[model samples]
Target: MGKSDCSKLHIAMFPWAAYGHFIPFLHLSNKLAQKGHKISFLLPRGVQPKLENLNQFPSLIQFFPLLLPCVDGLPPGAETTSVVPLNQQKYLAFAVDQTRDQVESIFKVIKPDIVMYDFWFWIPDLARQLGIRPITYVVVSSMSAAYNTTMITKETTVEEAMELPPGYPSSTVRFKDEEAPIVLSMARDFGSGLTFYQRINTTFTQSDAIAFRTCREIEGPFLDFVAQGFRKPVLLSGPSFPETKTKQLDDKWVNWLSKFEPGSVVFCSFGSQSELQKDEFHFQELVLGFELCGLPFLVALKPPQGCSTVEEALPEGFEERVKGRGLVYGGWVPQELLLHHPNIGCFVNHCGYGTMWEFLLTDCQIVLIPEIGDQILNTRLMVNELKIGVEVERGKNRQVSKESLSEAIKFVMDKDNETANKLRANRAKLKQTLSNRDVQEKYINSFIQALQDLVKK
Candidate 1:
């Protein structure tokens, strides 16, 4: 098609339907739509509420509901990609395969010009079959993309990731001696083992371009490595978040947080998908520690199935002890809004990329408490490399103790901690470096231009 004909290029975005993936894709879709592209957002039916919130962008975007096939292990009508159990390898594989088929069917209906997908196995083939360009959208940092796509190997398991090479960038290192074993086990047992890596390589080869929600300035070395190694067009969308001009606060949460002094409240939330087992008492210890610290807090709590109730997740009479001081919500809380609230001071986070970026963008003091996957690496980056956060020690079983949690929170939130001040100062400097409007616009425009170039080819 010619340039004039491309005035309204139809782009289909298939994010994994999880909050982490969906939120970033929503931001990208909105940006592309603002640039005059028509977006068909393909997602599971369950994501309607999330889609509802983005109703303002309805003019340039359309929603395509994916009806996931009912499999033996998967819950009936579960659509979000993150719903897959951590241990269920076969079910995840089947779901991915099914999602690909569903996406292909949607393509036939929409006939989009490009198919932008989150990291998945079947996207390339589907795109090729439809004569549409496929773009890989890495929602995390370029460093994360590099780690997953390049550094990870069967022989170089998570255990190996724990011990950093002296003087290496801390962001590139991993924690938890048990991480390697867990990853290796996950990769081997649940995933198609190393086969998933082979598939990812194939997808990378077939993709027309790779796009990241990272700036070259933030992760310059890793971005360069990826660009040089992949030999494919790499687009840096950098901190590609939807702009919120004024801070909006949840009044109740604001009132709750107001109970604490400035730089005192510690907000705790692991992203939506992180599920803690019912038997996991470490979570309880963290809560106890939070109570012991006497910090006013807001926690988004979700326990495993049959234990979904908040009371079920907390220790016996936990809420009673922390009552009037803590606010625990069952489902979604407006996170970005909460982070910007004045009364809110520090973050106790699971280090999900989305959470990390949101916190970083706001220049908030952070306490890194990573749970799984690349989170350990991200924690190291924030605490060790950036010196903006502190890490809590995990016990012999790799569980964090109440004392450790309480101490870490206290250490970071301490008014006298020179390290915390230095971190805040450094964060301010980083923010200034990244606050260029023209530069951000240039990156976005450049990325779109690269996509357009692929179309011409």
Candidate 2:
């Protein structure tokens, strides 16, 4: 397709309000804008601050706000990106419903040629109602898509999922003895997991195409499985890396990082929205373990609601023991910027899809500590299948001891280990394959060409 042909296309992008979902959609949006397609980004109001600087793209891209119904203790006018109590499943459902309403309203006004959405259930029906084609974007690895589709079904109870699938990677697949059944039931009953899998299957069964943020080179086995078995039009767009014009570091954080030797500091952050209670003794064990390692680290610590102080979230005198060796932030950090810094040796992460891609692109070693969701599966792949990282073992109480946490950190940071070096080399090869801009552009352009052909029909 020619540049002039691309200029005539209009695309609307809607992503789930969470950071992990929003960031990748934003990356795709930027790429589309660069290709001369008119792009409209629909997001909840809470994301405005983070998206404010996006206004610079005055010509090709525009942002619109969606209003969400307010709940008590949620900031007034909180949109999809706002942080809420994790336990509030009812509130999260309400937010998703509000997002659907807002998206429909905008679609009516814009009447775009195509609508691209994060894997949300309401989208397929909405697209049908509007006489437009919906493209579902799966943000995780292709393996995740296969696992969720094959394992989750109406007949598959939580108890059954507790047993590892044939050739499943982890010995830790079963939860602690007492909690195993409960965890299985939670996995089965969790509305989001069921909804996500259902939507993905439905979209594969119905949509014009399914788009994924993975290249065939990185996920050939799983991608082949989906294509040969499902026979859907699937496009393997490359990793949607963050594209910002600036590389400036946060001065305060850089100064703190400078105190440590080159490649000596470990960067620890579970992407935003993964929070734990202040009084949870597990929090203290994690802190004590980091202290015991005596590594210079930078941590992003967000205290749970009603925990009025940072001191309440940590072990007593924890900051004093670590002294100037550690720096903790109360709120969000520019993660891509931090990861690309020369001083960061390894990452301790919750293994969100976006963070994993960033870690891969930068060729950094990782220590996976997943708290929930598809993350559990992603952690398994990181350690057992890819051998690129390590996972921490937790006890029956769902907490890691100071001893276990300390040992896991030491294992990941040990430079002389043969396994670690092999993993690093594997990651370097993956990075080289994905760094090809020309190949990435071809996949994206081909997808766009297919959409253009659909418009003529």
Candidate 3:
């Protein structure tokens, strides 16, 4: 099948009930739609309003709402992981899984050519029952995906998982024993006596192929390893890098960043998934860090619900002291767009896969300060494997100190620094690699062709 063969295909997308998962699937849907294919994007009611570009291609893209099922301990408004607190995530996962019947009903009505899903472990079986083949779409680094699939399914002791996989490069990058249980716990057995790992293994096994939100150039080895280990076709769908258009920054932000030279400001954000501890010590440390680094910084942070202003969240006179040196905007800011701005030099990011792609596509120096979950592994890819970024040193408790943060900022943004120059050069090459429209199209077309072939069989 050629590129034109995909025009008649109808693709149904159901991502895990998390913004991180949903957004990537949406990007793929848009790509497929642009090629004249039909896309039915399944979104829970609560998250529908948060989606952008609904009217961009009204005819090709359609939203199909799946009402979140009621489950004990899951709040009514909590449909996406962004809204749910971290501690109660298990309940949210359980609730999302209960939507299986609703999904099946929708599939019967739509009768899609193929169904693509992320982290919905039950999707493969459901698609089979409905006479439609399912494809597992993983929105993570290929190594992380392969590691989880391999380690989680097999009943290996934590000690066994500590050692780096035999063929992987760098023995220093092995998983810590303490991190294994938390990773495994995220994969609830759901009465199947299998960890979340087994569920994913089974799902991927049932599918003819697995689709990843990554390209082969950066992770060719891990991709090959997963395919060989699992004995299934592994397909790359390309990195869904953001399409950056010059967006006008707010006057306040623009005015502050104007004082700094091009590539001198550090943009720090921890995304919506995690938050800095709302305490005097942590807040004071960040202020001191920025001051010591002497780099003008823009931080996007949301104060806790009870706090009315950024001042209430920070230490006394903190804002006054750093008035000209930095910015602390409460709530939203256009992050990807800001990264494209000439004045912004460095990004202190949480290392979410989505954010990682944004950082990769831009010239901004990366200073990874990952908070939780897969971000730690994502950091490893950036700092250890790719060698495009530096990670800040954290204390034994994983709390980063002001001194360490300051040093990291200086290491990346300092003009005469050799290591910093090399990182920028590597990042420029990566940006060029990711910018090839033909390369992206080729990957998407190949993925579509594979889907077409799967459906035909």
Candidate 4:
């Protein structure tokens, strides 16, 4: 079979419908395709057209668009998590669970050597029946994954998880008292006939091996902990870096950015997930923070909840007060790609795991303001553990004030200050480590070799 030639093996990938999971799976598929392996990428029908431009190796990687079946409680035409809000996303997952037969049919026909997936815990059992290996690949850090898996079992209580487990890899990794409810929410039924906790636990327990989009350099201790705890091989695919081919920035952005001095503009983005509610002590204050910082800034966010447009949500005279120096666009932009611009010296973001890897590779000073979930933990990894950034200070109730947010931005931007210099120097060192092409190559190559050995077994 294809096991004889690992380079020519066929693989299939099915990630959770969210962009956070889907994009990283595609990026991994692209890496495999570059090494002469073929990928059958299965995603929702509508999402296919959206991700067309990112399919750099179209000839070697084919997209099989599956129409998500309808489920009760899910709104009409809502297939992905991005379309439906978090609370209603359980219905979307219910619809995905209904696709089991369709997925099995495709697997039987393709007979892939290995199948990789994030959610859908039933996948490992299905692959075994079809005599194919199944690997659960997570996009989150091993630190997050290991900690969550240990502390969030099916029998876990909200009160129990509020305290750190008896023995964790790092004491630096902690859950806040106020964050207990959000953490406990994982136990809620997610409509896939499983709670979020059960689904994740089952995936790890059933999969032949677990893989992560991380390197030992960044998460060595946590990786070891996961391997020992799960009693399975843990493969590292390393971090995905920007490829040589780059997307051209728009003329308007180029012209505007060129007018500013090098390393002077603040580029703000919160990924493609949330439309921040204006009153969560998030949107308006964050907008005013950039204004208060007096930096030339570009903030790309959806119009806040309760407002029809970004212009409508701004504080009184906010538009006029920072007329030429600021912008708050209500649409998606190439903000991640723009990190290369010399004029973009500061990055303000939610510290998303994938985005953290991205910003870590760039020279821009990081300022974090995580909204919810593991993002807060990722911020701790950045601000406390790595010491490569500063976080916007949170109050007793975890709310961030305009002045505190502004101070975090200004702290990173102060080039002459000793603390700022240390942050930059630490960031530069980490960037060099991640940017080591040889190191990254070995991780991917070793990952593929692990798959071949598993198939042979």
RMSD list, candidates in order: 3.6, 3.6, 2.6, 2.1
Model 3 TM-score, 2 decimals: 0.92
Q: Among these predicted structures, which one has the highest TM-score?
A: 4
> Please, what are the lDDT tens digits per residue for candidate 2 over residues 421-443?
88788878877776777777787
Q: Is candidate 3 or candidate 4 better by TM-score?
A: 4
Cα error, residue 172 of model 4, in Å, equals: 1.0
In order of appearance, the predictions have TM-scores of 0.87, 0.86, 0.92, 0.96
- For residue 374, model 2's alpha carbon misses the true position, in angstroms, by 1.2
- Candidate 3 lDDT, 1-457, residue by residue in tens: 3464444788898887888888888888877777788988888886777785532567888888888777777777788888777766667767777788888888999999888886677787788888887888889777776665555444556666555665664454445554665565655553234556665667777776788999987888788888877788888889865454446777866777789899889898878766556653365577568777887888887674457766677766777877888788777888877888899999987799889888888889999877654787888878877789998887765667889999999988877999889988988998898899888879888877777777888
Regions more than 4 Å wrong, model 3:
1-7, 52-55, 153-157, 169-172, 176-195, 242-246, 304-308
Candidate 2, superposed: residue stretches over 4 Å from native? 4-7, 70-76, 98-105, 151-156, 163-204, 228-230, 279-281, 304-306, 453-457
CA-lDDT, candidates in order = 0.72, 0.69, 0.77, 0.85
| Model 1: pairs clashing at backbone N, Cα or C within 3 Å | 158-180, 159-180
Candidate order (TM-score): 4, 3, 1, 2
- Candidate 2's displacement at residue 418, Å, is 1.0
Count clashing residue pairs per candidate: 2, 0, 0, 0
Q: Taking the tens digit of each residue's C-alpha lDDT, what string does model 1 give over 111-198?
A: 9888888656578777888889898887866655555454345565555544444333443455455666655543443333434445
In model 4, where is the ten-residue run with the lowest total lDDT?
Answer: 1-10
Quality of model 4 by C-alpha lDDT: 0.85
Candidate 1 achieves a global lDDT of 0.72
The RMSD (Cα, Å) of candidate 1 is 3.6
